[model samples]
Target: MPSDCTHEPTPATQGPKLLEERTIGGILVHFVAIPTGVAGAGIVYLLATNEFTKRNARNALDWHLTVLALTVVTFGSLFTYAEFTGQGVTDVATLPSPVSTIASVVIPTLLTLWFLVTFWTFFVGLIAMGKATFGTAWRYPLSPALVDRYGSELDFPSKWPFVIFVYVVLLPLVIWGVFFGSTDGAAFFLSAFGLLGLIMLLTPLTAVAMYLHGERDQSRNTDWKPHVAAFVGTPILIAAAGYVISRVFTESMYPPGDAMYVFLAAFWVSSIVYLVRWWMTASN
Candidate 1:
């Protein structure tokens, strides 16, 4: 007879480990580090190693930015304008009739709006924090989906930094070129055409590459039709609608001077549509 023997399972035979990095980073950004503000949230996004964590960080960042924008529009800009113009209501009773009317009416209204916006920011931030803690997918209401619009293409680890670089550096350059480049015609033409060409070339290449690699490795089972429609249809639809409006209504109402605004609006709308569709497909 042999003595009783014991055996234990090794780490190699253990089941897959739970992923908590993204969840933790998200909690830190939105909940644990709320007082640290947007800078802290951005740091979380940059330091996040996985897509889930990055998405959470992205949500936090977008929420914070939205809050900042609301603050600026409601309170900061109004106060600054009043101060610079010397129209700020220091002593309402001393102000002239027109100024007193504005101070009495508009100032209180703006202050109320600011307070509402501030309260909204705090409430939504808390909600986002709760969602992140549970490892759920979260989107900030009314915040522009800047990351979701572009981040889906960033599946590859190596391309992450380059994408960040493009947003940080190249985007501002392109904006400057578009706005100011017309002053120097030759340089503008070359720079604009060159930059556009580079973008066009890279976009298709990146799409094809992602398709091939993702199909093989991850296989999202995405339908190409909705994406194709969104890409090819949005601009056409907007352009057609605008043309109709210009012709049927007064062309003076939506003049050529505002074409840039129309273009930007159309671009963002189309991008959001495409990203939403892509996310739905990927999630399925």
Candidate 2:
């Protein structure tokens, strides 16, 4: 029995391998960004559209939709550009180049900052709503200014502010990543982070749906049912749209690298749907 032999792996070593496998499986779902972006955008788009179309709702939907559209265009263009020309400033012309260098830089940067502010405003509004719902005596931080402009009743006691916040925080970050970052950045930061943000925003909507469903059992209110349906339906539609866009653009339009734009467009449409739904529901 003199020969030195290798021992078999212990259960302790095998445990880590098993855990790693599970983690990898979880991460795999995050690899597809276009679908996630589409879903998130869809949710916002439906919400905004609902608000804008509602007779009694405030006029905030118009602003929300405009910002959302601009953000998508900016990000989509950047993705398309990167797919074709590769990342970064390829041609550095001083002025009057085909590329509007100043506009490109300024627009993205300003949009991103504006989104951050919007997110902050929404966050505050959500907190205010929580206080109001719980019967606390909390006034909105900037209520006086908002009330002076849009009136207090229009701005208060609703989820629109928080919805806007989600848009502001998410869209700008996505645009920044696509326009400014590398391939890995696009995949991980822009896509993955964007999905995560969407999930975060969806959490509240899901809770609201659940609350509404429960309330329906006690009371006769059926309003929450549409929201729940919208919540479930929008994501599926966005995913389908993404797949369709991928197929159509890859087949009929530009070459392999240019297919990203199609995905972006599909996602944009999905987002519009989401905003519209929200706008309709939230209006008083």
Candidate 3:
């Protein structure tokens, strides 16, 4: 049902050769968001020599763009509202009483929607990739059929620079706002939730980026080990250091608030570092 256009198998000599499903699936599997999937798709689309390969690449590229546009319009607006009101990433009690109604209703609803979109994109993308490997030319159900139908007319390569600006320039600034704007406990949690939501969205995008950029550790055939080391190990090491500092310097147990803050701080810091490294590889 997902792949509406399954390329019928024909002799290798007839027309264009069939694009390998595993190669496409592998690409889809790595697709995360701007820095990863979008950039990766651009890279693949540019380098692909075959018509079939180009079509699949174009389809993937357009889908990522569509998903990114939808996310920005929906979550971006809500997060902006949260920033302006100072309710989401700050102390809620400080806000005027009337605003609470909006906060209680809007934040949860937006968060749910954000998660649904993220899950839907990843789930559908993965399924489509798997199906494509079996002889179908898969397309995202929600993706506009612009690339396949008007392949000749659309100049997708021109958009790559804008995509790069979004990842390297715009996103980092936005994330900074979400984190620093959140000054209170309630704000920290809410903002953290929002930031984490972005990270989740980036997960798939980054995967594709790494793959296309040839950043994968060929020895392992995956980058899981390094990510685990950075994500899990860094937090643990920071926590231990915090505990020591609290005992030796503060003469009290490590402040729970500080602990949580440090954990978040470490996570984001590590995430940024990893993304940068991956992006550099992908860009090259």
Candidate 4:
């Protein structure tokens, strides 16, 4: 349904479009976003040209982007923290002050954001759909104007949602599933795969964070090319690092201590690669 709905927007962009085309495209983007989430809106935003369609798609896209991000912050953060902390014998108090302090601060603020954005998207999105049907434009509250601002100069790839979705949603679920009381050979295989997936997930999350931050900072370069390159290349780097670690450790695939260093090392390498790509691209 999301794919079928997105096709309407792309074709209309190629020619002189009418009110009917723009209206339909706008409607499709909003409704598609409801089920397909951020990815659906992203596809429509990248392809659709008519101002009504593009603006609404971008607005929905940005809101859903925030929702997707907050989903991880609210739902996934504690799970991730438990995962790592559960591995070792250190007390939660022994964790760096920043870790505990940040969690305390983030948890409450995140709850507030959750409520505001949910209702904001619903009211605004419904109005957007209704108005678009009548050929009127509706913009979301507190929009960063991502499309209106950087859109002209940048060539944003449509694949961003795929990258974002995997990291933001899919990998976390997989990691949780694999480690759900793991044992023996199955544990080994899952651990190895999950280790790699976790490292890879960070790359996309950073990509999203950078884009959101860059949108606010005028000094940052807006080109999406380097981001695209980093995400594409980082997987190989992650896998290779995992392979080396697995070879050196041999039987230490289990977590807590055996695989912790390896996972951290791989994550470090990916972070380094991401920064290099960002610097080379002059991204902020």
Sort by TM-score, best first: what order? Answer: 4, 3, 1, 2
**In lDDT terms, how accurate is model 2?**
0.42
Query: Candidate 2 on 1-284: residue-level lDDT in tens?
Result: 77698788776533333332232212221121123332333333333333222211111223333345556666666654443444433332343435656556765786686577456545543453344333332433432322135434544433443443455345545655666655552354456546454444444344343333333322345352334454445555665666666667656454332334333434344445555654575574
TM-scores of all predicted structures: 0.39, 0.29, 0.42, 0.44
Local accuracy of candidate 4 as per-residue lDDT tens digits, 1-284: 45654444445445444455556888778877776556667767756667788877888887777676776676455444444444322223354667867876776787777877776676777777886776665666666665567667654442333344445444445556556635433344446656554554454344554454333222344563434345444544665666667767676555344344444444445545544554566545
TM-score of 2: 0.29
> Candidate 4 has what TM-score?
0.44
Q: Poorest 10 consecutive residues of model 2 by lDDT?
A: 51-60
Model 4 alpha-carbon drift over 4 Å, by segment:
1-21, 75-77, 80-93, 96-102, 149-284
Q: Against the true structure, whose lDDT is highest? A: 4
Residue pair clashes in candidate 1? none
By how many angstroms RMSD does model 2 differ from the true structure? 19.0
Model 3, range 1-284, lDDT digits (tens) per residue?
59788897776665434454235533453353233555556556655665555666677777776766666666665655565566454423355657756766876776787677667767766675665565554677768865566667544542322332334443455467675664654445456655554454443343334343332323454342344344446765796777667667785654664565465556556545655654565466
RMSD of 4: 15.0
Clashes (N, CA, C under 3 Å) per candidate: 0, 27, 11, 0
